[model samples]
Target: MALTREPPAATVDPSNPNIVRWEDIGLTLIHNFITEEEEAAMIEAFHAQDPQKEGKRRISQHFGYHFDYTTFGASETHLTPVPSYITNFLPRLPIQTYLPDQFTVQYYPPGTGIPPHVDTHSMFDEALYSLSFGSAVPMQFRMSGPNDARKMRLPKRSVQRKSDENTEPASSPATAEQTQANAQAQDAEEQSACWEILLPPRSLLLMTGPSRYGYTHAIRPRKTDVIDGKTVPRQGRYSITMRTVRRGDEIGCNCAYPGVCDARIREEMAARRDGAI
Candidate 1:
């Protein structure tokens, strides 16, 4: 497939130096990021290793840095050597400098799905990357809020990015005042802008910015996914998640995203209000 060209100059967001926006969200999905032969080679390599069972639903293996699957933390784990295949491929990616230091291979059987949630903030760097193999699945993204949540789907065989303004994690439980305000704010604009990308087999996803922090992404638990009015059955799936761990003890971050930054909150406690944005 031809390279998915960068967005035309007119579509680039002046306010966000890092992203090319479509509507209010900044995400780019590069179709056919990997070849079938390469994907097959990865699967073969994975099968050659002894993968550890994660809880009861997933079998996985970690390299470079061991991550606590339940807590999604890696600060204390000892760093180990990653497989040559992963390290060799990392530098070939477009965002080579953001290359991952840790990767996990997760195997999910049919009917299994990941719950809706954002990757834990502060524990990992801004960019989250995933490589798909074995099967194709539609990953869903739903905006988190008190009002009706909108949905988006990720197609297989593509790479997606989450840009800066939308990197905050989903909001916590709302107070009574916020609930009331959310009820009142249920207009067209309030409807969370949603996006869907078809991630084919051998796809890659790099999530950053708001799409990484602001919305929640999950895979619905079922045997089939409805796409374009056609039902597609789930198959055995494998996902290789790569992330760069954040170092040091937790402290106030100075990032510009007020939605998820504690420093911004402490600095403007009294001035902030519900729906201030």
Candidate 2:
């Protein structure tokens, strides 16, 4: 395919292009995101700034350690804070924001990794902008076709299936109608968009477009033989997923703090405070 030469300038879209490989995907990279020294510093900060130990934020299923500072969003994110070298090479792309939400650093220790899941946003197309450092992990991509199955666990045999395989692993066999139900089940599970790529250290991974709709991507953590032998333990992996949120309502709170309160509460709080004067 000829490179469309996307203006070497980033462009926004209701439909944004998801790049699987730079040589083919057409999206320009931001740069070698971090130097070895910088990576070391951030990794040190990640481990030192533990959410479990810190009281400001809570630990999440996203894995690894995370830091959700109260003022994270208010900071001036652009202007090449880390220097032009780390600034975006594709300026036309959506200017990544570190909105007012709590910061989360997902650590995939070796074999430990996040399963395939869609982001939980109700409105407006958003993006998952991630900066990776240290080592490389293969992210898996799967497409969601017409049928649906939202919940089904996989056994060891199914875990080895290729990323393109379409059959669902049901606990038992099914008849025609039953098969339809199973297909629906599988489709529901596969409905969300997904695409995965290995993000080596000092690299960035942006998930949007079909990645947000047609599929859910997963980072297959690096695994190794464990002492128990029956299980393979994961190695150390950390990724920072910064994103925007869409609330499917006329009104919503933009605060990064997710579980504490809804937009209504914020409005009510503002009203009460204003009346005090």
Q: Which lDDT values do the candidates have, in the order given?
A: 0.61, 0.44
Candidate 1 structure quality by residue, lDDT tens digits, 93-183: 6576667777888888887887556665566777788788788887766555433221111111111243322122244455767656545
Total backbone collisions, model 1: 23
Q: For model 2, how does the per-residue alpha-carbon lDDT over 1-277 read when each residue is reduced to its tens digit?
A: 1112232124433243333333222332343565688777766755664544333222332221122223222123322122222232334334545231323455554556655544433322345566666566556556533331223122224333444223335555446787677666664544444333445666766655445444545664346432333553444656666555333362243533232222433455577889942
Which runs of model 2 end up more than 4 angstroms from their true locations? 1-31, 51-102, 123-125, 146-149, 152-196, 221-234, 247-277
Candidate 1, residue 112: how far the Cα is off, in Å:
1.2
Once fitted onto the true fold, the runs of candidate 1 whose alpha carbons sit more than 4 angstroms away are 1-24, 51-56, 146-195, 249-277
Best candidate, TM-score: 1
Query: What's model 2's lDDT at 102?
Result: 22
TM value for model 2: 0.47
Cα displacement (Å) at residue 116, model 1: 0.8
TM-score of each: 0.65, 0.47
Q: How close is candidate 1 to the true structure, as a TM-score?
A: 0.65
